[model samples]
Target: MELKLYRAGWALALPAVRMLLARRGRGAGMRFLEERLGRDWQARAPGALWFHCASVGEVMTACPLVRRLHARGAAPLLVTTNTPTGARTATRVLPGAVGHAYLPVDTRRRVARFLDRFRPRALLVCETEIWPELYGACHRRGIPVVLFNARLTERTLRAPAWLARLYAQALAPVRGVLARSEGDAERFRALGAHRVQVVGNLKWAGCPADPAGPPPSAVPYWAAVSTHEDEELRLARIERMLPSDAPVLALVPRHPERGPAIAARLRAAGFGVAVRSRGEPPAERIWLVDTLGEALRFMAHAELVFMGGSLVPAGGHNLLEPARLGRAVVVGPHMEDFAQETEDLVEAGAVVQVDDEGEAGRTIARLLADAAARRALGQAAAAFVAARGETVLEAYLAELHAARLPLDRAPA
Candidate 1:
């Protein structure tokens, strides 16, 4: 069945290959594949496992696993990610591993070419990325494919029946699934995933920020992480509503490109300001850490954090990042993407959900007024994450092994 699927997918190669001549910025993903993988790409790696993470979050989750594999003598494991940001994070964090482009859009030929070249013993896929043709091609070549930290949302559950059926068929090629939570496992089963198991969120094991780093001044500040335009604007208003004696604000925009624009908006709003990444940390002004790779560090420095993506309908960003750092968390109403985790935190007094910026500001003011209450909330958040531990890793590694091909050689 998988072979036939791959055969049908082979037809997509014409368009995929043509991607090379298309506009560089547009269809660049496909173009990248065509340009990078030349003829005879089926050459196998000497001794390596392949881990595919779609973006920055998944890259962070896969870091510990990659290190564990290295400790177990799996050197030179190949890492692949679709986004430029993911690639940068992987390269920066996964030290000593070979990094490569992800197999291009599910065209059989592209997948085949990729497998032939990387010839990894096994393929570990993070989260919900399932490419039928890619998995089918791997199956055809006797390579194992596994889905790790898999998750299926309520929206995914309520998909049109036909679409769900199609998705089930698409997922049929993978050998096993390591779901991030019990809810995730149940959803996968409802959607026809086999060999599914519940693994706690890998975010629990996310690397901690260096405590030795210079301490941010002991000012009463709240962090707004991974925020978008709408959220940022709303937060600026919230900041304004705070009492003049309130601590400075740490606003980390999700995209670095928007830093200047955000800074301008904040300044125009009549708030004294400093941009952290621009060497402008005003001793008594708001600090906009317009940098990347340090959201968690800032969280550690914050008295409280309002997670981003919740303000608008973007399905909230990771609240666990702050929770794990022992910070009191506040979030906007929209969190369907991480419904279960967020709710759990709320129930445990680890998080507070506000309807809008007004509520967020009010909540922060309340917490700021009561230091003991804030500490208590932060403690609970930390405890919740610590309890989850490495359960996610165990389940994911188990599933990956189920589909693993024999290792060509151990790392020396």
Candidate 2:
């Protein structure tokens, strides 16, 4: 009953949704709909393995799993993403994929058409994308579906009964749900997922090898990464609190387009700033990394790293990235999105936790002043990450093998 109502509502809402997507400048998703409506999907390769990633972070988290699938002879991979940035990253990182496309809209007819055209043997969804129509279409076609690196927050679990029922129905068709943590696994079970398992976060599987390039700067530096609005001003003030001989600071905003404004603000605060997009390096006191896909590079040269989005109300970006890079890490108190992971890290002495910007400054200053302490923190962080086994990927592979899916190697 809930499923029928949801389908009816979704059908009625699709035209408005399309208009909203166009208004929001999601040209790639719009183009995909146009092509599908024109029956252009008939021209693409069929019966490939399909993976769907929602955005940039999902793309990064799915990268290692995609590579493993490809390495295991999963030929003719197809990657579908909801956002242009995700599509671009999929194309750039998973060149082995036969093609990339925007995920078809969630209407039953459109999703059915996509399933028929692609004829994928299995569908792998990253994170929390629970589309009822899409899952139903796959189920009707007898295609297996799996959710990897799955997470369900408190907000989702506590949704009203009707909406919760809709989610339960949507998740019913999924063959397996490999959750990022035990908490997530319980939530999936609560939503009526049948074959849920607690698999550690796939983000811990590993990041892509650093590209071959010189360090962004020779000077010792500290990096503030994936920062959100107003975080730059707060971080710059924190930089002032550091001792005169502290390492240079690198500010990498979550949205690179904010670079010019961030640089201007930092300059107004009496600090020398250089914007990376403008070909500026760490020559100044603060180097604003106004680019994408280079956070790891900047992190490599940092004495310590501050994971952003936490100081404010944002749920915090990935702390594991810097931890994997063996950098001493600090984060503010608002890590609700990563509550379990952050708590575990703090308990293990793998990270420094601060309540506010002022505490962040003082904590960073103290860590910077003690080289031995910084090194110890970095070591603990790296070790902590290493201890979380990559058995999730292995378990996924075993499941695939038991199911006897096609994984013939693709041509090099």
Candidate 3:
């Protein structure tokens, strides 16, 4: 009864979804609508491997796997993402993908049409994208639906009963679930995902090869990455507390549009600031990285890194990125979304956790003053990430082969 109501409600919401997409702008939004409505779009190839990454973060996590699949001759892979940024990253990073597009709204008919058109041999849903209609449609067609790098937070597990039941039902058709941690695997099982396996996180697979040419900036700096609203002001305060001779501070907000506002705020607060998008780095004390896909680049050159999102309630961005880069890392108290990984890193002494803005300032100052401590932290972080190895990706490939999925190395 509840499932029927959900289907009805989703069907009724399709028109509103179309209007929202149209309002977002024409480029990818219009293209997405046209494809969903069964006009002006075609799949690059039938029986392709399909991967869905919801946004930029997921795109990063999916890139390595996509590259491995392609190298093994899984040609004509189809990638779909809900955000334009994700789509762009997918296209840029996974050049082997036959196509990249916004995922269609999850109405029954639209999902069925997508399945019929693409005819993917298997569908890989990246990190917490549970679309009931799409899963059901693929299941009916006998296509394997695997959840890759899956994670479930405590809040999600303890959601209101009705929503929890809906999620459980939505996850029912997944053939396999590769969780990021054992705790996440348990949550998926509690939410009705059968065959859950603890495959660890693929983000630990390691950082991308260095970009060709010189580093983005040669000056030594401290990086504040993926910061959320008001976190910049807090970071500014922390900067003021650092030693007078400490390296420059690079402020990289999670959203590029916020760069101007952040720069203005820092300047208004009487700090010397330079925006990266405007061109060359300044000799100012603060350099605002007003761009995309360059956070890792900045982290690579930093004396230390303080990941954002944790200062506020944004569940924190990936702490592993900086750790993988072998940079001394600092985060705040609210890393609940990355609970398992955060705890493990903290236990290994690879990351420093502060309880508040004041503590963050003190911690940064202490690390900056003691170069030896920074080196120790960085070395520990790199080693901790390296210890995870490639077990996760290997497990995923083994499962895919065992299921008799089509692949270059699989028997014809």
TM-score of each: 0.79, 0.85, 0.87
lDDT of 2 at 252: 88
Q: Which candidate do you rate higher for TM-score, 1 or 2?
A: 2
How far does residue 109 in candidate 1 sit from its true spot (Å)?
Answer: 2.5
Report the lDDT tens digits of candidate 2 across residue range 78-98: 888776777677767775545
What is the lDDT for 128 in model 3? 91
| Candidate 2, backbone clash total | 1
Better of 1 and 3 by lDDT: 3
Q: Quote the lDDT for 171 in model 2.
A: 85
Cα misplacement distance, residue 167 of candidate 1 (Å): 4.0
TM-score of 3: 0.87
List runs of model 1 lying over 4 Å from the truth. 1-44, 74-76, 95-102, 153-166, 186-191, 208-220, 260-279, 283-287, 355-358, 398-412
For residues 42-116, could you state the per-residue lDDT of candidate 3 as single tens digits? 556677788888887788888878888887778678888887767767766776545775677777777777777
What's the C-alpha lDDT at position 324 in model 1? 84
Clashing pairs in 1: 42-116, 43-116
